[model samples]
Target: MPVNPPQAPTLSGDLLTIHRLLQSPTQIQRRLQTIQDLRFVADKILTARYRSSGGAVLYDVSEPIFNTREVESVAPGAEYPKDVTPEGAAALAAVSKWGQATQLTDERIKRNARPGDELDRVLRKVVNTIIRKVDSITISAVASAVTATSPAVDNWDVSTANILRDIETAEAAIEDLDMGYNPDSILMSSTKYAFMASDDKIATLRRRETTDNPIYGGDIEMLGNLKVIVAPASRLPSNDVWVFDSTQLGGMADEAEVDPGYTVGEMAVQIQSERIARRDAWEVWGRRITVPVIQEPGAAVKITGTNP
Candidate 1:
């Protein structure tokens, strides 16, 4: 005969509050197991989608084709296939499988420097030299323009005006060094970004600084006021500020806040979402070529290559 099931025990408190009364270790364990199973299923679906999109599988074909093909021989010996059971899926998802996380120490260095810090002073000089180099290039390009007179006499004035406007726009961009964030720096590093400055320009500026002047006496006097000109050929604006924004700077803090409820899987998803959003936003609102190019100043005059 089959055994009879146990009858329910009466509770001292309200019967409606059944959750408090049914706190058996076995029941708790079972519920936890069920949750784990569901998580496993969710993980399998996610893993399949991920793998189908770009994941790859490696197999050892040395084993027998049919009955002898075991999971161990085909899949990684230590790392099992994520497509298997929920537990396996969960384990894969829970692990840190991404590249090493890095912090923007250079940005912090840029931001945390006091108004007169030596590093701050150095950065200012570097930026100013870049601006000067860009200005020189723009001037030279304009000076080399071939003069072009309109066939119709009436349009000559308009053409000349447009040429002047182009020059002004190009000059303005060279004057402003504020680009979006130091996106290039984030991809590379501050050292690399600084290296983009021409060696001659950097060397020239380094030799001209005052040894013991008040830290804030020159361009390095203000935190965000330093203007670094990029190469004119690069055509970056003079006012563009290459520094990190709040979101990029906050990444380290976000990673450090992980707790019990937050698994590595959740954090990875958040990071992916953040990167995607940042990339989309950058594509939409980042630096744009706003100025129209004018033929070198002498182009309209029909002068060949030679500046008058």
Candidate 2:
């Protein structure tokens, strides 16, 4: 009788089921998309594809004119011409890594959800970080926007304040542009939003009075024509605020779908060294991309104050 060869050890228990999670690469992508949707800033801006090195181009044309001109000496009104402008921008990507060989330890695999849960949290952190980065770009865009500062609501720490008065002033800034873009978003820091939320005017109201109004109850309140947002303080300073139309000025450019998918193999085989056993390692990696741009400068303006 011939001697039999030895067989390599294999994974068991919940690790067996985990292959189901790793096998489906699209699942990771779906989770990453969910992360993007949860991020306030990411969900609000434009998304475009990334061109290699030279960045990508966008086209812009002057607004259309209304046909309200009377003919003079058989001459038609100023004719609109075929005019288009090409603008270019670039996208940047950030990558994050998680997981380790210990996650695949024999006893650990019995309660495999532990490792899986840890990986999920790590991925969420990565995606959230990317969203914050994108928000910074938006803040920069509004930093130098047309002025609409008002002392009445200028300082958040001020003893006497009025959110409505400040908002009215900000809306005037957008309308003053006459760009036809409406102020649809009210973006602020969490700190600033908290100030508004706890204010006597918003926080204290009769139930019957607020039966038709939701802003009176929530920290993130809304006006008739504007949606209030309490963004992260790290991303947007509490000292400044903005009212703008995302469709007209804000864009997320192009972003690649994240691939938080993983692969299982041996440390020695993958790294080309006597690292460890064949099933000693696992890794979670993914990519996030974005090119946030301000298309219409006049569409968004910084309100509030610039005091020390």
Candidate 3:
């Protein structure tokens, strides 16, 4: 006997059937992946990931302050370790609800007449808008928590600007803190990153070292050992850059509860859909209830005045 593979169910008939198909586990998982793919920088910078277990309006976050104490050696049979209790403070982080909604009309669905095409289109737009909002919130929180320092002389955009020296100085500042954290990554505006990549000194070095590669080819993925993260200007200021240790920087927390009709998807994002009988449309909604918390401020340094 020959067995046939099952076919994907189509969205042809009633609103109930279409809604059920859209809310299927497979389709929901696909949508969740789209959200994660869009959040490149936010996921990188926010190293610590957490989820809220209860339905709480404010998320509680606690960060331990590392004590700078050395372990003392003692004679045999003596208590060498000092009696020191771990110290930390807990603070309430306000979790903001971010969401976007889109509708799939009967006319549009009928006109397309394809299985899940119209629904996918609506989900894509709604998911993108929600991700952008979440990214903006995360970036703004980091900017506010860290202090900015202006370059002493020329900015990176200038031909004479010593970009390497500036970056080294920033790294030194973090190392001097002796907080056991060294800057491992940098975040900057795309425009500034482009300028740095095409800078005269960088190009000369790359061209001289790797002659086979084109002069204008390849992105500035790393400055020495520091990883570079290029972000949109709308999220980060064009003239600003951040040098930080991702391990000690901070974390992000999201709501974990999944409502009756809602699905708790990847990165703790919740999504729901409703059928509007009056309008003969399906309204799709996606939301993220989360907050970004800065645990160690000294682990990050912001370099400003990168351009005119």
Candidate 4:
């Protein structure tokens, strides 16, 4: 016969009352302040920021394409050079709602004894879950918008891989556009970073006696002209690298919260709580109303097959 574990005793008396709940809305906000300090690479990727007006559901992303410039020496009184105009396109980014919730059951509260500790733990998890969702969404938008992809001459993990040359080629693609976009940032997984850091050429440069500066010290801060950003595999593919100008790449837009008591934060995350009388439980909920808009896809170049 199979044996089942005994159930935890129900929490009653003062514990069962909504008034006795350990986490009030005020307490939730305080906890959120501490959690909000964490930095997300996605935020760094999209340097441009926007706020949606109340009751707004969509954000318009403007894409401008510049044509070749005509500069020439003119006669003394000649009319000014021909006017320059850029073909423009726009994409509608639909704001999506993302939420995560955890229920604090009566049995769980009774088992923990300290309800405050339990609530804090659950609240942190709820917020983190929502943040991950937002990060994934932002990275996905970047990948989709950057339709240009350059396959590595050789896998980055291989001994023959010319990481520096590959990066230069990728950067050249964006610069060749002549649209004034400079590829200033590189996005990749930590695994690919380690591979690049351990490559023979990089190792040789570090050992050179003539130079005091190295490509990487404690962290992979800068590689040549590009600032390195190691993204989580959950957000960026481990086998791919992205080189782009953050200034022109894209941005994030979030819907403003109009609820009487709720105010949006830098991350645009909101936390809420509800009491269940019959079940004698408290529900912790976290949500974000946001969308990532890719404004200039040409500014970014994706280098795939960086890893095995």
Indicate which candidate wins on lDDT. 4
TM, every model: 0.16, 0.65, 0.81, 0.78
Tens-digit per-residue lDDT, 188-292, candidate 4: 887888888778877775545434333434665788888999877877733589999999887777776546545345666777777788987777777888788
Tens-digit lDDT track for model 1 on 40-139? 1111111112211112222211122133234554545566534322111111111122221222222332333231232223323332333344334333
Q: What local distance difference test score does each model get?
A: 0.24, 0.50, 0.71, 0.74
Task: List model 3 lDDT by residue over 123-186, tens digit each.
Answer: 7777778777777888888888777453624777787887777787888888887767778999
What shift in Å separates residue 202 of candidate 3 from its native position after superposition?
A: 1.7
| Ranking of all candidate structures by their lDDT, best first | 4, 3, 2, 1
Lowest lDDT 10-mer window, candidate 1? 282-291
Best by TM-score: 3
- Between candidates 2 and 3, the one scoring higher on lDDT is 3
- Which is superior by TM-score, 2 or 3? 3
Worst window of 10 by summed lDDT in candidate 4:
55-64
Clashing pairs in 2: 46-252, 48-253, 48-254
